[model samples]
Target: MTSPSQEEDDVEEWRVLYQETFGYRRPLFHPEHAVFQFQPDPKFPGHQRNNNRERREENDVDEEEDVEEWNPWKESYEQLSRGVHVMNSFEQFVGAADIQCFDHIDEALKFLDENPEGHHEKLIFLHEGTHNVNHTIRIASDVQIIGASSSEDIAASVILTGRHATILEIQEGARSPYLGWITVKYEVDTEHEAEMALIMEVDAPPPPEPNSSGAVADNDDDDDLEKVNEIESDQTTNCAMVVTGRGVEPIIESCHFQSGNADHHTVVVKDHAAPKIKNSKFIGGSGGGIIITHQAAGYYDTCEFAQNLRSGIRVQFQANPYFYKCAVHHQGEVGVFILDDGLGHFQNCDIFSNAKFGVELTSPNANPTITECEIHHGELGGICVHEEATGQFLKNRVHNNAFLAVWICGGANPILRQNEIFDGKHGGILVHRYGKGLIEDNEIYGNVLAGIFVETGAQPWIRNNHIHSGKQAGVYFYDNGSGILEGNEINGNTLTGVQIRTGANPRILKNRIWNNDNGVLIHEGGQGCLEENTVFDNTTTNVFIQTEATPTVRKNKIFGSRETGILITDGGKGTIEDNEIFDNGQAGVMILSEATPIIQLNRVHGNRSAGIEVSSKGECVVRENRVFRNRFGGIMIASGSNVADSSLNQVYDNLDRVSKAIDRGHCLFSVSGKEFYPMHNFYRCITCNSSDRNGICQSCIKVCHKGHTVMFLRCDRFYCDCGADHLERSCCLRQS
Candidate 1:
């Protein structure tokens, strides 16, 4: 038995011997573990090494302790078992189609123009493997340049980092001052070659020396300003005029773009050109990451933009970029920035920790559709829909933002609906003055401030939402916004569940507001309608009319509140009627200020406080009610509220008019009352009555405190079965 390493050495010798029989250009030549493509050898004398025919019954002998390492008997068995196929390196790899490699970037760019391989099918690689770019390369129509990977597996082997622009902005300017002062030619005249003269008359111009002021004195101050204005002509312009302009379409995909690491941009398209990009990752340099100008619709999808000094993607001069499914993070200043009426539609992108907003579509008509994206844990809001820009946001989950979920200052109509927003310090949606927008059906919960914050003068129609568990009310209407608030279930919030303040006459109707501190609180001169709502079980008052707002509170089931059911504090008034207010801990109605209320026809009962309590000195009428069975008096007129000899207020308690016996236990009752509205006045009859506990038929007299009584046929008190009673005429009763 020989060693395994020695056995491998024998195999390499046999492979080298067989490769000399065939002629082939080699690839990855190593003696021991060489590719069989280069070393196509099979015929060897050591291939016929026969196996050992020793005695069976475990006849094995090895004096060496490391038997696994010293034995080489099984080595040749593997080579004989699995035959190897020699790969032809020429046929294995084609001559690298779709890539025009050049020794220099200039040569590669020369090929980009003369080269016919554009968007149809072609890719370029700047394979100079050096960090030098004295001449820039302008990307022509529909051409892509991708860098080469070092290894086949692409682990880590690109040592050469060429500092060059993957796509450079070909700047073109006016030839002379006459072109700037043109009164006739409006559009860029690219056809007629105007022989425009050079304005600069520089003869043997000196090299522009830096660190010694700019072509003049060091702060000549007023003189420098005059000199700057003198050279402000087209002579100092650095632009090549478009001799024959072409509508450019190019995509700089999967290339390492470097620009001196200064505050410069990577891909600069200053002209009116739109580039479509996909599946590209960019490691940016000092310049702006991507700059679009004029009317360029730069469409980018599934791109990763990271580690840039300036904005991730910037658009200016009415040029915007449409982005979809792009990851933009770890940028220097702002991410996905658009200024000066530039617009873009951003969809399904992860934008977090950006210094500014995720996507900024500023100015007017710069609207965008931002939908179906999870924008969470961002430094600012998930999206800032402001600056006269409108947006349509749907099905987005914006959570854990430092600011509001969405900041909307839309000057026009913006629609933001069906978004679940939470975990922010501010409101979920903030609408400011020039903001006209529709907020509907957004699950805004567990935030610090109001859910939908609309300021004064914003009449946005808010409808159909589930807002719960916010720090303030669900929808805070302020700043004179008279929107319609309907069909919203606002529950379990801390403050007024839905506050319509700031003189906003919001139609607060058909909203199920419950379990908050106060169900619906209105203040500061908003005269609106609050009708057809089941406002119930709030901790504080159901509806608080504060600060001169007189909302019409009618046909609302205001019940089970801890404080007054309808607390009309301050100076607010409404016609209160037909509300089934029952079983609350406080009064069914509380009227404060100088509020003269037409209180009529409300079923106010079983409240601990008075049914209709007045707290102000005013002329009011409380008329016509079966208001009874309250813990305190039915109607309490407080100290400062009762007018001078109030005659219009009617109160009723235990009225008898030939009525039948009361259902509970009243002993004596008249049965011949035809026109009766529950004409029986019922009581327990404790002193002269007796009946079974939990029995359906209540006694017609007052029951005793611990014992009942018996009223006989002649008004005598017999000892009833349940208690002890007195004797008036002739009947007997027992105490039981």
Candidate 2:
């Protein structure tokens, strides 16, 4: 253990490290400007510490075309406030290159107008300035009005006063000069207190639990390694930072851009060159937080855009912005808006909500690649695709939205794969108006409507989706829609599990349909093939083949419903073959007056009512069927029913078997017939406590963890322990 004095020295060394590594410049508001140690060396590539040059180089990987010019959270520790001291040696705020006052937006415009040659290699630093850029201010052509300092003695941040539009109505010598200050003292205090709270937010770390292998470790090698190799991975900061205006290709990295001008945007680009902004934060503004517009592609990596009023990041007008490991959360409106003329490719972004859509795509005919995003809790849908927008959504967690998980309108086709869409109040994916796509391998559950609904000529292939617990059908094809619904596990939907209505002809194959109100409901003109599907345990019937829809149902297990297994009526002529239909509330197969389904080689048994009840047209070849154990007669062929050719069908128990001998047995299991063995793991306790339990959170799961705590992850059943609080599995167990 280090002594108090030694601890103090350690603290000093840490302060130095902060200064050297992240440029925690004394009281600097934005942490990004601090030079980062990516790997290997602190200043391995260059000496300036700022990543502007390196970022520019990275941006050059994709050659971009430029049409116009572009302009481009401190936690409190009151003692370690993130604002840097005013540079005394340099003029406090009065260099021709530096600014101490704004007074109006024109002053900034004037500065830019004078720097028409471009402020390259010159910084228009704003320190202790009462600059009120209430409106837009163009930058140094390629200039940086950076409020980021370079000092480590303190949490050096940049602060510029925004008293824009405040009228001076004070009486200096009339006994009322200081009265105004006193009158507004409490309000001023409240503002200061809020600022203090914002500053005091410390970047806490996450807790630790079981290892990746789900095993417990005795030592905290991971935690120690993390600390020893800790860099400023967190990029959140105090203010809204916006850099806009002209330049060929302006580059921005590691910036904290806060909005205080009472305008709507935090950091924005109206019309400018391509920008490469990585490792930044934009927080707490009323307007659209980060707006990237004007036809230039933007690249943002590892940035956090949180606590804003409008959309987190608005990409508009032919702009292509690619985001990697970015977070957009807690906004008033949309999380990320891909408006007309622009598309966004988002990778590994966490987008929750404060108000509206988590991700909104408005442009028609632009399908962006969205990979591995955790999108949840939107006021509207997790993702709203409108007007011919097309994209591939892969490896995403889309759940808990107020509206549909994915709402596609006006002919948008989004190929969805490997997504978990669950627990939403509305439908899962609604494809309307000629949208053509596939919904495959998605775990879609707990929704109100059909998991996948296609309407108005939409031909979507719905496959491999585990859809359950919805209020309506799991997959509904309606109104001229045609597709293939195959290989899906659809169960527990309140209504029909797969509803094909309104002329929709969907080939339903190899689907596991169970525990639904109706397994498969077919309405008018919905004629398709139901092949090799395991449809069972529905409340009403396994299949409700309605008028004029004669689907060829072959080789299916249709049973265990409250009513008849297969209900056919109104001239429905379905071909049913080799189906195992049993244990239904009514008959195994119910045929109405006009129904004439051809059934052959089916195991129809154990129905409470009848095995094959026909009124008018059950003229099926009842041959080779195993009909037995029904409460009533197996063949209840009543008036006008033509049940002919009932030969070779083995009937028993309920006196329904007409042909051969039958045997009964229970408890059937399938075997893999492959050789396998079990493995064993052993362990011993060292420092045994009074109670017998796992010693460490690694073993138990009750302790704090590590990292900048960018997200809150609840630990598993085991407690959490990591970071400063690691456990000693037992004080005795030793491999040494």
Candidate 3:
């Protein structure tokens, strides 16, 4: 075991280290600037041995014994001598004032109240013991109370215990009283407190009635009588510390607070009081860690809240606080709860391992800016913005929650930007139930469900996001969800990159979708406009429309698919127009299963199979498209399916199947790019003088015959004379 002298040296070293870490030169009202003096306790005579050694050397009167006097000012403990100090035992470093020892905190408080020798400047040091106080101790001045021992070990230091009462109430006008290095635990005697509240209500009188004149009569006696039945309805009583009133800004640093009352808070700050609390730990409290309400605002830095029965911090009723670098975890409820117009700025906070959501914002006006925080390991979710709450969440890392990392619902409209929301049990972000928000510039990936799941009438503007690398779709719209998905990189998901179903209609515009099972899948009555998207390199078809989905596939660059570029099957009906569909393993456009669609104005090329295929009784109007460079044939129609109007299409340069189409009685003029819908005007080559076995349309007479021309056939049937086989001149429209 170490000697007493050695223990004193260790405590001195600790005090010096603490000051070097947190000391700053400021006003006397600030705890960081409070000066502490290391005075020896008269009971501990071993501390004065250095002084005795100096006297002994002076009496020796030798050359070596005449050394200079020991100077405490030049010692290594100079930092502790200048600012706040941490002490090990009760008598390590007493303050500059008279060293007054008190066995009970109540007695010391009474002494300071009655002495009145500038109590604001006095420092009352509580010894290392648990002092029980039955009532609250109210501080009316700028007194400084610090406990002996390090704040890290609160139970081994000075402890103040109270039963169903406010342990410390720094009342109004108590400017900058510093409370540090102590543990305050308030116990709730629930049965007794309930009975007392009942008795107070029974003895209270009714409130006074309004005057007939609609004005209060200025009577002092009536005002005094009316004060008899005043009970605080805000539930701010029976806390470990209640700092109230305007301008009562105390410094609470390195303190531990615990409240056993589950319905109340450990620290309650209300009525415009703004305190500076730093480096404290609110641990294992049955109640919430702190409540800042009724316009109370404070600055909390580097504080830790863990194992609380309720939320770690509750900010409501227009309270606006600032929290920086705080760790709030292991709470029974949410880590942070902001409601009822509560406003706060949270930065660099780590909120994790909560029973419910890590951070929950509710009510219409609960708007707070949370940035650069890590919120993870929540039992329910990471962050929830509900009940029409609006806030800005920027650059936060939210992951590994039980459900979605962020949930925006119930008409909430929060801006989620530059956040990495991933690795959850469900989706990364969920916007549903009529929620409207701007989710832009966020990296949402590695989720079990969709990266962003929008459903149930929610319409958010999702732009400029990297929604990728998920187990399911990148962006899933379901059950009437409508949103604008623009300028996003949706790729590398195990399922479809974008999935729309069940009447969900999202305007998918200007997105780069690749490397998924399918680029965009619309099924089960889904209806949306897929416009201006570059969808390529998917494992399956680039776009799949089936099961009665009538989505408008327009103006998209759909290519580089393992299967067909666009697949319309299973009774699906849509307008596929103005799209560049190419470079697919199968046909560019595959229509089957009785589906009726308008395939018009598309450039279909570079496919391994036919450019456009109609099979399985599908009926489509194929018009005004450029079908070229396909491996099989340009446009192929199976026996059962039929094209309602295969007209005005430029179908050329397709090899191997043109003769098959001709043998099946298809228009030979279509191969030379001159066929159209059944026209009443046809032309015969009168200059060549051939028999009109198959009459050509007016386009063929103008381009193929030119000046050598022909007489108008005036035939109503769809016919072309280019396949007569007895014509002397070759067909000029065909590529020689």
What lDDT does the true structure give each of the candidates? 0.54, 0.60, 0.79
Candidates in descending TM-score order: 3, 1, 2
Candidate 1, backbone clash total = 37
Measured against the true structure, the TM-scores of the candidates, in listed sequence, are: 0.61, 0.58, 0.76
Residue-level lDDT tens digits of model 3 in 1-736: 3455664665555444533332321111222434333333222235344664666666874434434433232232333332222233345434443334455666666666677654233556554567788889898777777665434464346788889578999879787887876788899887987886786789875556669978765544442122434644347778899998888888887788999988788989888988888888888888899989989998999999999999999999899999999999999999999999999999999999999999999999999999999999999999999999998999999999999899999999999999999999988989999998999999998999999999999999999999999999999999999989999999999999999999999999999999999999999999999899999999998999999999998999999998889999998988999999999977899988988889999999998777888876888899999999886678877655779768679999876344554445444555433322222345677787755555665555665677975776443334455533335655554433
RMSD, model 2, all Cα superposed?
A: 26.2
In model 1, where do residues sit more than 4 Å from their true spots?
1-101, 109-123, 141-144, 151-248, 256-264, 269-272, 282-288, 307-310, 315-321, 410-412, 502-504, 524-528, 572-583, 593-609, 616-635, 643-736
Local error of candidate 1 at residue 339 (angstroms):
4.0
* Decreasing lDDT order of the candidates: 3, 2, 1
* Candidate 2: worst-modelled 10 consecutive residues by lDDT: 177-186
What's model 3's overall lDDT? 0.79
Clash number for model 3? Answer: 5
Instruction: Give the better candidate number (1 or 2) by lDDT.
Output: 2
